[model samples]
Target: MKGRLVALVGPEQVELHEYDLPEIPPGAALLKVRRANVCGSDLHIWHFLSVAFRDIVMGHEFVAEVAELGEGLTTDSAGQPLKVGDRVAAVYYHTCLKCAACGRGDFSMCSNAVASMGAPPTSPPHFTGAFATHYFLSPGQFFYKVPDEVSDAAVAGANCGLAQMMFSLDKVGVRRGTNVVIQGAGGLGLYAAAVANRSGANVIVVEREPVRIAAARLFGAHHIVDMSELTTVEERTQRILDLTKGIGADAIIEVTGRSEAFAEAIEYARVGASIASVGNLNVGEKFELKFAPAWITRKQLRIVGVLRYDPWYLRDAIQFLADNGDRFPFDALTDRVFTMDEVIEALELSESRIVSRAAIIPV
Candidate 1:
């Protein structure tokens, strides 16, 4: 059998390639791509802005159906019965339990997290990215069967964006009655709002885009700080304070992918509060720090930089969708869809922000 994949050959360039599928190794599986989303990190990789990700597969967030199961594979990581054709979502990265970080129980920080994903598409078992028609699940990779109720549109992002937000919020202690401020109303921010709202926290989203502002409310934001109206750093800070009853946010989440948003998150955080820095992946001369070290020390803030989440969180994300999929418009998050041939268009639209979320159907 043959599978197709999208390969990044250079900055802002991609090519579609096809190769014979390799035999599924023991404890591994092969999945046929169903739905994939162009996540923010995809944009970064597309632009060659992400370190260690150049000339590789171009996607990570997706849901797939089991096309073939390797020998000795019978159940998912959660012990659920698995079979060919079962819908599943796998952690895009590897979690080598032998790694130092995994030995310390920090699976998310595994030293070889990208061992498989970092492989170039030209390698055997060439279907490594979600943008492709198939994905090869390496041995010991964590995957969960998707509930029958969750649409592919709703569950495609479970692996990356939604799962990461759930983990990030948990890391920062977002809970009932907490004033949680979300920076940016993009996919990550919207997911954060929905998670915080379901936890009974006061979800406050900060954004300038009208479409995203409306989407934020639908995703359960209790209040929104309109950047268009606030117009200044001081003004936005006062608004955040007002929304938090003069205490500032008990938890702040930064997902704007802008350096200024990181500095702005400090202003929105209350004393002793925690901030989850999930965006702003870039580093170097362009993304210089805009905030002062004194503020973090004086306020005693907890700033956590979250990358890909713990593998099991993908299971929790699927469960979250099963429990609350009807409560929020998860299907609507992807405003546009493109076919395998239109993958470039999908990337461009997502990069331009013309489509908040773009889905790729690679069948």
Candidate 2:
């Protein structure tokens, strides 16, 4: 059977290509995408800023249903029974167990992480990304079935933003009474806010956009540092200090995708504090850093740059939504929905910030 996929032809350009689906190999599966989200990383890839993803399939945040299970495939990564037509969320990246990183049990840092995600659409299977009619799951890929109580809108982001936030927060030791500051109020920031809040941390979000500021509050931010009012880094640092009772933040999360935000994170962090650098994926002179390395040595800060989470985190993200979906506005995160034909419009609107988040439903 034929399947269609959106392929990146150039910077800010995409084209729909149709090709016959390849046979599902043993221990693999094929899925029909039900809903896909346009995340901040999607924007990075759309602009050709990602060196690994140019001329490749265009999406990674999505939820799909099993269209066909290959021979010998009987259960999910968690040992749950799997069946055809079950809703599921798959980890977007690959983890080759034979790789050096995986050999040391650092699955998240697997050397071949983008093996499938960065493949060109002209290749066999031709369904590497979620912006497509079908997605091919190769052998060894980790996937988990979605719970019935969670809506597609709530679970679609579980694979990307939510899982990463959950992992990043856990990585930085965000626990009860920890003063945590999150920069930006995009999907990743919002998800970080919610996760930090649920962890019993004092959540403070730094955002400038009105809509996102309100979203930060909804997602359980105890305080919003309005960039409109406090326009300077020093002023914002004072506000953070004031909010933290002059101790500064115990943990800071940078999710603004702006290089300046990373520099500011150091200013907001207390001595011995940890910063989770989740954004700012681009690397070039344009995204250069001007901060001094002395600051890290003097303050003794822990900075972690996370790209993808361990595959098992997706399972935890699903369970998190199933347990707390009602406490936060997970469904409202997607402000706009578009069909396959409107993929370009979806990308444009998301890029222009006309929509906080966009969803694509394959026709």
Candidate 3:
């Protein structure tokens, strides 16, 4: 079989190239890639904004159909339990089932974990990636069955954004009446806002982009703070404080990965408040930790950094979206779609802020 895949040849370089499919190994399954989403991390990797690597297949968030099963794999063509016709979303990570983290259900923290497609040959023979026309899958990792009520686009975004939101909320202890602030209203921010609202928090969204702020309101943000006029961190902090009646927000989820946003988060959080940092703050980037002592002594602020989520968390996120589909219009978050041949264009548009969430249909 021959399929097209987006390859990161070098910094700021990406191209769709054709490759011949390899043989499937025992305990492995082959999937026909249906749709792949351009993630924020994909943009970071493309710009060399991330750690370097040689030529690499650059997609992780994707959905597909079962095509074939290997010798030891018991599934039928279209992969037994999941018929050839079943539509599914692939989890992006693989972990050692016997590890301590895996035992604790923290798959993301497993020492032997690797990117779904980037795993070396020493790991799993068929566990390659979903960016191509057909890719391999390994055992022990979960593959979710996408419900009929969920659209392909919604599942693509939910694979990451929705799971991240649920993980952040769970980490920060958001409650029914808790006041929450989400920084930035991009793809992740919009999903976080909807998740926070559904969790019964009084959600406030802070975004510099007016267009995004307007969209945030439509996505269930109780208040939208236009950060355009707020010049200083102090000003932004004060604005957030004012919105929460000077008690400050009970929780703050930082999604922009901007240094200034972290500074403002530290400033706006009430003593003992929890801050979940989901954004990728550049390494070696210096920001004032002026409130460190106060945060520890007086406020007892709990600062937690988040990474990609566990499979169960992703499952819960899917259920959340499925249940609250009416309240949160997951469809509205998607700005456009392109074919697999237009993978480069999809990445470009996402980087330029021309679209919120973009999907690439590989089939």
Measured against the true structure, the TM-scores of the candidates, in listed sequence, are 0.98, 0.97, 0.90
Off by over 4 Å in 2: 285-291
Best by lDDT: 2
Report the C-alpha lDDT of model 2 over 225-278, residue by residue, as the tens digit. 999999999999999999999999999989988888999999999999999998
lDDT of candidate 2 vs native? 0.93
Candidate models: Cα lDDT each: 0.91, 0.93, 0.75
TM-score of 2: 0.97
* Candidate 3 lDDT over residue span 166-284, tens digit each: 88888999879899999988888888888888778999998888888888997889987777888777787788888988999899999997876876787778988999998855776
Tens digit per residue, CA lDDT, model 1, 277-306: 988787863755667899999999999999
Model 3 TM-score? 0.90
* Cα RMSD of predicted structure 1: 1.2
Error of model 2, residue 284, in angstroms: 1.9
Q: Which ranking of candidates, highest lDDT first? A: 2, 1, 3
* Total backbone collisions for each predicted model: 0, 0, 4
On the 0 to 100 scale, the lDDT of residue 323 in model 2 is 87
Candidate 1: residue 242 lDDT (0-100): 88
